[model samples]
Target: MHLPPISLMLLQVLALHTLVFCCQASTFTDQTDKQALLEFQSNLSPNSRVSLASWNESFDLCNWTGVTCARKHKRVSGLNLSGMKLTGVISPSFLTSVSLSHNSFHGSIPPEVGKLFRLQHLNLSNNVLGGGIPLGLSNCSALLNNLEHEIPSELASLSSLVLLSLRRNALTGKLPASFGNLTSLERLDLAYNRMEGEIHEMLFLGGNAFKGQIPSSLANITSIREFDIAACDMTGSIPLSFGRLHNLEILGFSYNSLGSYSSRDLDFLGSLNNCTQLQHLGVGYNRLGGKMPHAISNLPNRLTYLFLGGNFISGSIPHDIGNLESLQTFKVEQSLLTGELPTSLGMLSRLGRLQLQSNMMSGEIPPSLGNLSMIAELLFYLLYPGLDYNMLHGSIPQELMEARSLVSLNVSYNNLTGDLPREVGKLENLIQLYVSHNQLSGHIPQTLGSCLSLEEISLNRNLFEGSIINIRDLRDLKLLDLSNNNLSGSIPGHLVNLSV
Candidate 1:
């Protein structure tokens, strides 16, 4: 409290100045952010302008539309203006990374977007933005940019990319062979587009609509997990090298035109025995023929679903199929397979659905099928609901009734003779009943009315002779086709609503 000299007073004045300067510096940063917000708002629609302005306070940018700030106040960290009905082309000068996916940004992706060097994720999916992908994207150095445009060779520069989703766009042209340059990519989705060109070696197009021959090089991407090129118009042979993809889990090449070099080209399928991690393998709707490779039985116990339907595959189904104990859905419909149904099929303890229709399968319906119940609680559903076609001669085995969990029972278009099993009505969950186009039948079982969940019942073109009884009690029936059956009785007046 002593009165000091003028020198002491000068020192106190300097300390006050330092404090004021620090406050002013903070205020300046806030002002700068406000100015940027004003610029961004001016480019928006009147509705958007008002919405953004309400959240763009001078001291807080986090409240602004699609914006996320870091720990420090008012510093722009993440901007997500996606699906905002924004009409203008992206202005890279205003921000770093931007997302206009599923919006109305209808012009070409501005090349200026590449100028934002800090961009990490740019998603422009589900938009009308056209024109070739800007090669300047490489300048951003981030790997997660959307490639809704054609694959640009300049993308090789995004060596840090980890995920790229460009699916469901109008992108075309071949993938740049240099795609492996993005060595850090883990997931790539190019599905549901017109992307063509041979895949390069050591590359993965997981969840993409890539067409043309699968590149032998893809076998080198040992780390790929979910590889899907489904419905991509792909043709030519499946590469034998695919067996080397030890880490692949979900491999789908369905709905394509893939054909083998010759009838015995199934040798390539044997190579897949090494893909121990594969769980879902779909190569349906192709022209591959010959016996299924025995090595296919070597697939790991983890393998569950196997679809080889709609192909030209011939030969008897190998008993080794039982080795796929975890199989839940096994379909080989519309193929040229010939031979008796293997008794070993009973070993599929977990099989829920088995489709082997429209093939030259002979011999009786194996009693071994009854073994399905001895193994596990069956979640199986057999679907053969359709108009009469083809001939499958066999007795309706009572052994099938043991599958207590059966939800659908269709044995139509076959040569058979047997009385309606009263146990069939025990399937309380049966939704479809197709037993038409067969020989022999007794009185229509009134017990069938107990099948409360039946949605469809087709018993036409058969030699069933009896008055349809309690037809009105089948209340759940939506479509009932019983034409051309030998029945001596007047039409059930209450069944008018049952015919479809």
Candidate 2:
């Protein structure tokens, strides 16, 4: 009823042949993967406690220890050889190769493990290897692992590593000079270690105690995007070679003695014009000098914070500073800068804080400064303040007081000689005003009373000759100094009932 006898018999024979072929392929894969697992366990150096006794033909390959097989192909897809007193693991990928990263093993990386040509990713980070490793890999993380002694030059052979995070280790000795050979390296994090020498990258070596100048060789890595080496105790000038890094975005050199206060100390800043993507530049508190670079005006408009304060910088702020439209903070106090405030500063509509105090600047306060329309989102920020402790003269610009976002104003210790503008009342959030030691005259504006948030007022050493205005509405007033002035009135009634 089905088919002819010979035809049916041939069809059955073909079906049986296909079944045998499929079984043979499956058995071949299992034996190969089983042998690979056994090889994996045998390669682990020292007396590894990785309980891999079950990785045998007696057990199913899919059910072997730390071995994971795919649901359909049933091929060895992952291996988590952790808790072997070691620090490596594996994962799935194409080429069907395996990986090893982030585990709790405690042996030196065995040469046998590296011999596996099919291995893909290997991250043996955070292993408490109580003994010694054959070599400390320089281009990968031994982070928080207490790996000691000098990093040998032989470890630089791992040229394929992209991120080498060796932070928070006790690894001592000078950084190996052979590190420059690793051309594939991008980010080198050597922070909080005792490694010496000065190399940079995305470069989180901020807390180390290296004793040399930052090597100019770092500039060869033009692909760098962020380079931060702050507080590393490295003296000497920043290499001008750094300018070659056209892709630099965030450069931080703060809290280090990096400059000599020479006339050209800060020339590196101008050299950064090619780094069009730069956003945050913090070079404050170094011994850097030279005039504020005119190229600063040409800095990327994307620049947000520029902190060059607490240095030996001289000359004037760049007149084209307003070009940094995205600038939020401009701090250059405690420098040797002179000359008048540039009118272009007022064009920084996004500027929220300006610190130019303790300079030798002269001339009248630029009236254009009031044009700064500080963003209203912040609850506290010194808006266009800190023009104090200079040789500035002339009256407080009424325009300056018009910046409604100003929270604190300090023009004291200058040679200014004008009546405080009544527009000050427009600063409803004003908390403090210091206009002391000036030649300001005329009745203190009653509008000052409208600023109910006033907490401190230092109008002393001025020529103000009238009674204190009725600031009874200023419930937050804490300190009021009107001394050395020619005022002939009693203390304001606002303070009369207070327990000062």
Candidate 3:
């Protein structure tokens, strides 16, 4: 065992060098991960705008564009190739975060993606990816997509999932009840899909072919604010439980077959009274019929827009509709409505647009309507208010001219007997005036010439006496029809010369 001190020192130095070499060898290059990334790059078509030329065997995987590695293990941790115009099937990699959104990437997302057990975020949105989402992605927290397949129920296992958007895709199949397991989810948009089944939360599934009844389970999503399932093939009355959504603000169920022509069909309107925050309600173009429910007037005062047109709804519009202090637009045209227009509508000081044409409403235009100083657009023509259609008898209300902001006035095809209001010229902003096909008798209002903004004037088929006095002054008139009136005298020479 006896040895020179220098020999012993040399052995110690050798031992130290061995340990250093072992440590360096243990920190080997992640060749498997690197090769996987290279394979993904190879699958995409070559794009002049997006070159992954730096992804090669010569360069460290961490140094590749769109690649990031963990600090300690130096393993690929994230891959963000968003908006790169990369086109190809997505290849799986052991990444924690993967975002290839807004690209031209097409083809099915490989099931191999599910192998990323550590994946926290995955976004393939705005791509043309087709095929089912793999169940293996249950570990992800944020799952966004542009996928065309059934939403896998396995997604319910992602307890940490918060945001899921599969909009503008051809996704089919029903929403799985297991989705209730995602307690942390805040926003879910599956619009423009072919998915069926009930919805929950702030759901937006418009422009989809979703069928079946809107589930009453939706009441459980008390936190929901916006629910839009319009343009779907849903049937059955709107769930009365919807009233429980006190926070709901916008509700759209238009263009769906949700009800039949019965009083019970609109029973849901009573439930909505609890939704104090409700502002917009659209249920037009359905099979809904029955008297306009008085419960509609009980809707939230914050309601600003109400559309109930294109339905079989009968009876008079609820006079209490004027209670909607915030009402801005009210559309009830093309329905089986009867009775006269409600004069209380004048109370809607904020009213801007009103559509009540194509109904069985008779009687003279309400003079109270003139109180609508805020009215900017009005459509009540195509059926004379006092002519052949509804048997309305009265003079045209001069009060209407008080609405200085009025841009359009339509009251044609009625059986009214009176002269046109001379104050009609007071509507300085009037661009269109339709009072044709009536039984009115009198000279054309001379003051009508003051409406310089008039672009269209229809006064044909009326029992008017005297010549068209103001016809010569409407220089901006693009259309003028004053024929069939009992007027006498030669046409004004200036009127014939105008470019109408």
Instruction: Score candidate 3 by TM-score against the native.
Output: 0.69
For candidate 3, list the clashing residue pairs, or say none: 384-412, 384-413, 384-414, 386-414, 386-415, 386-416, 387-414, 387-415
After best superposition, candidate 3 residue 182: deviation in angstroms? 4.7
Query: Model 2 — which ten-residue stretch has the worst lDDT?
Result: 87-96
- Which candidate number would show the highest lDDT if scored against the true structure? 3
- The lDDT for every candidate, in the order shown, is 0.66, 0.71, 0.75
lDDT of 1 by residue, 1-500 (tens): 11112233333332333343334455345445555556545555565555455554543566766877656555565667676766544444333455666665555655545545555666666666666677776433222333355777777677777666665666677788787766666556666566666676434343345557777877666667777777766778888888887877888877878886367656777777788888898888877777766766777778888889888887788878889988877888888777777788778877777877777766667767766754445344442222123355667677776666666777777676777677777667678888887884777778888888888988888878888767576777788877898888787788776654
> Which of the predicted structures, 1 or 3, would earn the higher TM-score when compared with the native?
1
TM-score of 1: 0.78
Report model 2's TM-score to 2 decimal places. 0.68
TM-scores of all models?
A: 0.78, 0.68, 0.69
Give the clashing residue pairs of candidate 1, or none.
143-161, 190-208, 190-209, 191-208, 191-209, 201-217, 202-217
Candidate closest to the true structure, highest TM-score: 1
* Candidate 3 Cα RMSD (Å): 11.9
For model 1 the local lDDT of residue 213 reads: 77
Please list the residue runs of candidate 2 whose C-alpha ends up more than 4 Å from where it truly belongs after superposition.
1-173, 176-186, 189-203, 374-384, 472-478, 493-500
lDDT of 3 by residue, 1-500 (tens): 11112233333332343343335455335675675576566667666125788888788788988999878878667889888877666655556688888887666666655654556787777777776777666555443455667888888887766667677777888777787776556556677878876564336688876777777877777766777889988888888999998888889999999897887887889999999999999999998878889998989999988999888888887888889978877888788888887888888877777877777888778898777774333432211111124445687888877888777777777777788889987877888888887888888889999999999988999988887685666779999888998889887788768987
